[model samples]
Target: MESLTIRRPDDWHLHLRDGDMLRAVAPESRDMGRAIVMPNLVPPVVTHDDARAYRERIVAAGFARPLMTLYLTEGTNPDDVVSAHAAGTITAVKLYPAGATTNSASGVRSIEAVRAVLAAMEAAGVPLCLHGEVTDREIDIFDREARFLDDVLTPLRAAHPELKLTLEHVTTSEAVDWVRAHPGVGATITVQHLLANRNDMLAGGLRPHFYCLPILKRGRHQEALRAAATSGESAFFLGTDSAPHPTHAKEATCCAAGCFTAPIALACYAHVFEEEDALDRLESFASLNGPAHYGLPPNADTVTLTRGAALDLPPRIDTHGQSVTLFDPGHPLHWHIH
Candidate 1:
């Protein structure tokens, strides 16, 4: 096929940072449809006011009605959930286990402290977006996500059966099974995990830009994610989680964890799905599934992508004295944006 058209896709989870970084990178994603912007800013988006202001900033930066998320804190006000939801400023509350990922030190130290907020969300019919990993130092890095499911999430789900939850950037087979087994739970599979395994980070040499939280897993897990996303399941969808960090920050001694995939996320996803022979189902995973899970309508606009064209993935985005490389800079995508 020369070209394919589908309903505009929304990024179910994204971290656009703030200020110059936000403005510099927002358009690439905006070229797609609405996105669920993460709330893990420096101070963390823990209040309705924070979410509202963040939404306003995103709009001011030229993003068309970006979906906003509240960063759940130990002392998050339950009333804020109602107010934010009522105002239509916050689509979901993000649960980040303290120190689970970037700027997550302000995340909930214990799930117990956020129970009231969760209850409010359940009552308000808002979804709970989760980072899904235990912060316990004893838990091996590779096993944290699975451990969180067994030790924390299982009980949390049982306790909050009414609450809607989404496991973000799920990388393991266990997460796939968990979402499949639970009717109320859904998930977003990131492009990076679907395309590469943990070994990709150190393949020919150490590649820091490929590093991300819930770091890439074994080939089996990569295959599992590919299957889940391309299966056209209503419970599975796309979330680029296209985190970007300054080049200096990423190339430093202890490089920050993130992948700058915004510039080429759709292209990469199209290539992967096409390779799997599931290109026909791309629209569901990219556009329809996420909105359905969140009880929103799919966007009316559409984007067309074409195959058999070469698209040059930028090596780096130079903004305000710093640069950020696009994720998977070495991979050649078979698809190109039209």
Candidate 2:
């Protein structure tokens, strides 16, 4: 097909760091219908007021609709969560499991510690977004996600059967199956996870650009992610997890983990679905499933992708005196949103 048109897509998970970094990255996502902004900043957005302030800044940057989230820290107030939901200030609350990812040092250390808050969210019909990876030092880095399924996610579902959850940036076959099996549970797959596996990070030498938390899994896992994303399943949808980090932060001795993918996210997703011969299902995965799962209406507008020239995008974006790298999908994309 030379062209495709679909409802404007929404990113169920995205990261726009505060201040200058926010200005540099937020505009790249402006074309999206809406985005669920992650709250893993240095201090993190732990209250309704913080989310409101962040939303204002995103709007100031010209992004149309920014759906904010509160960071679920051990100290998160259950009453505050209920009030936030009631006030319509947050779309969801993110649980990071402490050191699961970038700026997640204040994430919840134990589910028990946050049960009251979880219960509050469930009562208020607020969804919980999870960075589904275990932080147990004893667990192998590769096994953390799978272990998280058995040790944490599964139990949490049983405890709060009605609590809506989206396993953010899920990267394992195990997570895919679990989400598929559980009702009221959904998962968001990142563009990087769908396109690259572990080898892309360490095979021919370290490729720091491909490094990300819940780090890329094996090829079999990537295959599973592709199948789930293109299967036209409502439980799975697009979430770029387009986290941006300055070039210096990513190349350091103890490099940070994230792939700044906001710019080419949709194009990358198009390449994946086209390869699977599932172009027909791309809209459902990108634009429909997420809204259905979140109980929001699908966007009224549409975006057209014209397939004529190879997709050309900047390799890096410069702002705030630092450069943020863009994700290279490793294959030429002919689809360009018009």
Candidate 3:
């Protein structure tokens, strides 16, 4: 098949940094029906008022239906979280372990401290998106995610059995199996994870563009992600985790962790689905499953990916004088989304 059409997709996780960078990258996601906007901005969106205002700014930046989230903090008020979700000011609450990723210094340090908040969210039906990794200095970088499963998430899951959870940008074979074993948990797989493995980042020299938190795992993990995403599974869906960092920061001694996948997200996902011989099941991963997990109806609109000829997309997007690099899959992408 040369062309395929399906319901417009939604991004289960996305990061559009505030201000000029937000304006520069927001339009890149216009083809998506909605995006669960990360709230890790400076000062972070911790309250209903904060999420509402951030949503307004995102709308002004051209992302019309940004589903805003609150950056969960140890000081987070349970009442504030329930109210925000009930009022429709926020879609979910993001749990970023302290120092887990970029701008996550204020993340929850003790999950026990947030137990009341989690209970409130569970009582109300608010989804909690997790950056599932432990920050202990001893755990090897590659083993953090798997360790998080046994050490942190398992007990948390057992305690909050009724809570809605979406494991954001999951990158391990263990994580894939864990999500499958759990009945209602959802997982978001990114373009970088599907298209490249840890080898792509560390093989010859570090390809900083592929460096991201819950850093890309081994090739076997990539194969697991590919199989899970293309298997028409209900628990896995697309969330680009499309984080952008200025070129200077990315090329620095301590480069920031994220891939600016927003600009070419759909095409890259199409490329993966095509390679897996699962183009027919693309709609289930990209469009159907996420909404079902979030308890929403599928979008009314549609997008078509016409497969032919390599796309000549821009290498970077200019924000002020700095440029944010776009992720290159290191291969010719034949699918162009329209």
Candidate 4:
């Protein structure tokens, strides 16, 4: 098929940083209709008022409707979360195990420490979006996610059965299995992980841009993620986790972890689904499932994607004084959204 049309999709997870970075990247996601904006800023968005201000900035940057999330820290006030959700200023509360990723110094150090906030979110019908990785020094970096599933996530879920949970940018087969087995729980998959693996990072030399938290796994894990993403499972949907770092930050002595792909996210998804021979299921995965999980309606408009011709995406995006590199899928992408 040369062309395909589907409901306009929402990015279940995205990161448009503050200031010039936000201004530069927010516009790239305009076609995504809506996005659950991550709250891992410098100070982080931790309250209803903070989210409101951030939302205003996003609107100022030309993002039509950006869904907000509050960073879940140990000190996060339960009442604040309830108020934010009730007021509709934020859609969810994001949990980042301290030091899990960029701008996460204030993330929760222990699940027990944030029980009050979690309880409040549960009572308020607010979803909990997780980074899904652990920072235990004993655990190998690549093994953090699977270990987190066993060590933290399992117990957290058991304790808060009522809390709606979404494992964001899940990168392991173990995550796919657990999410699939649990009904009502959801997860988001990034296009970068769908196209690349750990080899892409270390196979030749260090490819810093390919490095991301819950670092990309091996081939089997990649296959599992691919299957879970294209299987048309409601538990799995789209989350670009399109984190951007300055060119210097990404190419430094110790590089920050993230892949900026907001510019070509849809095309990447189309390529993944089409390669899996599940093009018919793309709409459900990209558009319908996310809104259903979020208790929102799918977008009324549609986006048409054309295949049979390669779309030449720019290798990098200039955002203010810094430049962010775009993810290279390492294959010809024959799909383009129109």
Candidate 5:
């Protein structure tokens, strides 16, 4: 098909850092009708007031209608969490296993320590977005997400059955199966995970931009993620964990963990769906499943994508006195959103 149109999609997970970087990248996600803006800022958005202020700044940066969230920490107050959700200041609370990703030093060190907050969120009908990976040094990095499912998420699900949970950026077949087996649970699949695997990051040499938390997995996992994303299942949706770092940071000794794909994510997803021969399901994965999981409605408007000549966009965007590199999906993308 040369052209396709669907409801404007929401990014189920996104990261817009504070200040200059936020300004530089926020506009990149403008087409998303709404986005569940991540709260992993330095010091983190830990309270309702913090989320409110951050949301204001994000709007000021140009991407409006961001559904804000709080960064879950060990000392988080349950009342603060519950009240924030009830007051509509925050949509959900993010749980990051300590040291799991960038700016996550203050993330939860122990799930037990945040039980009160979790219980309060569950009781109040607030959702929980999880960075599903275990930080135990003994567990191989590749095994973390799978281990988290078995050792952390399973029990947590059992303990708080009503707590709405979204497993953010899932990268494994096991994760796909787990979310499928459990109804009402949702998972967000990132563009990088769908387009590239660990081999793309490590095969020839280190390609830092492809490196992300719950780091890219083997090809089998990549296949699994693509299948799940293109399956039109309600449990899976789009979350471009489109993290950005200055070009210098990404090319340095310890590269940053993310892909700066916010500028090109939708077109990339179209390419993935087309490759899977499931363009018919693009609207469901990109625009429908997310809202259903979050108890919202689909966007009324739409964006049309046309398959055409290879996209000739720049490989990087200048921002913050430096530049952020956009993800290069290896193959030339023949799609553009109009």
Candidate 6:
């Protein structure tokens, strides 16, 4: 093939922080096309006004069309849910278990709170994107995701059969099965989790940049993620979760949990699909599946990617008076956009 061309893809989950960082990084994602902007900002976007202002800022920074999400908080107004969605200000609401990940201290503290918002969202046909991990301190770090599924998500789904859910950055085989079994649910697999396992973070030494919430699992889980992502199933899609943190933050004692993968996300996903010998299905995983799941129109724009090329991803990006690390900083990618 001369070049692999597909509809311009939408990033189902992304974190483009405000101000200079957003300015510095927005273009990399805008160059791709629309993205579902996450709502875990410092104060957290919990209302229609917040989502609207945030969307304006993203547009002001030159993002083509950034979809919005509400950060589900305890005592969140169900009326706000209806207003946000009805106003076209938000595409979905995100539920981050309290303290589950970055800037999530304000996340819903219990399923009761989420149930209220989920009920409103279900009635309005809005999806609930979950950061699937339990915050209980007693749970093993690696077991949090599975525990959340068993203790929380499973029961929540049974109780609210009408709610549409998306399991974000799913890391375990059990998660894959959970999404597969539930017709009302879907999953977004990140490139980092699909390509690397837990050992990769400690392969030679501590690799903080590769660390993320719902942390990477064992190799068998990685294999399951690969199958789920490349199977061309509608229930699975691409969500880069390209969270960028200042380099100083990542190299510190307690590194931030994120991977700045936007610059190389397409190339990395191509590498994975090619290795699976499923390049023919790449468009669906990266482009088509997301819109289908979101009930939005697939992007009409197109991007061309050529194979057999080694592209260098910068070791770190100097932006907004801070340095940010690229996900696979020192690696050479096989695919390059032309």
Q: Write the per-residue lDDT of candidate 2 for residues 109-189, one digit (tens) a residue.
A: 889999999988898899999999999999999999999999999999999999999999999999999998997798999
lDDT of 6 by residue, 10-38 (tens): 89999998888888788777546788899
Q: In terms of lDDT, which candidate is stronger, 5 or 6?
A: 5
Q: What TM-score do all the candidates reach, one by one?
A: 0.98, 0.98, 0.99, 0.98, 0.99, 0.97
RMSD in Å for model 4 = 1.0
- What are the runs in model 5 whose C-alpha is more than 4 Å off? none
TM-score of candidate 1 against the unseen true structure? 0.98
Mark the regions of model 6 whose C-alpha exceeds 4 Å error after superposition. none
Model 3, residue 17: distance off in Å is 0.7
lDDT of 3 at 182: 95
Q: Please provide, for model 5 over 55-172, each residue's C-alpha lDDT reduced to its tens digit, 9 standing for 90 to 100.
A: 9999999998899999999999899988888898988899999999999999988889999889988889999999999999999999999999999999999999999999999999
Q: Between which residue pairs do clashes occur in model 6?
A: none
Whole-model Cα lDDT per candidate? 0.88, 0.91, 0.93, 0.90, 0.93, 0.88
Clashing pairs in 3: none
List ranges where model 1 is wrong by over 4 Å: none
After aligning candidate 1 to the native by TM-score, how far in Å is the CA of 338 from where it should be?
A: 2.6
Q: Name the 10 consecutive residues with the lowest summed lDDT in model 3.
A: 313-322
Off by over 4 Å in 2: none
Q: Relative to the unseen true structure, what is the C-alpha lDDT of residue 211 in candidate 5, on a scale of 0 to 100?
A: 88
lDDT of 1 by residue, 1-338 (tens): 66899998889988888888887788778557889999999998988899888888887766877889998888888998789988998899899999999999998888788888888888888889999999889879999999999998999999999999999999999999999999868899998998899888887898898899989999999999999999999999999999999988899899999998887888888988988999999999999999999999999999988887577666888865557788874667868675
Question: Cα RMSD (Å) between model 2 and the true structure?
Answer: 0.9
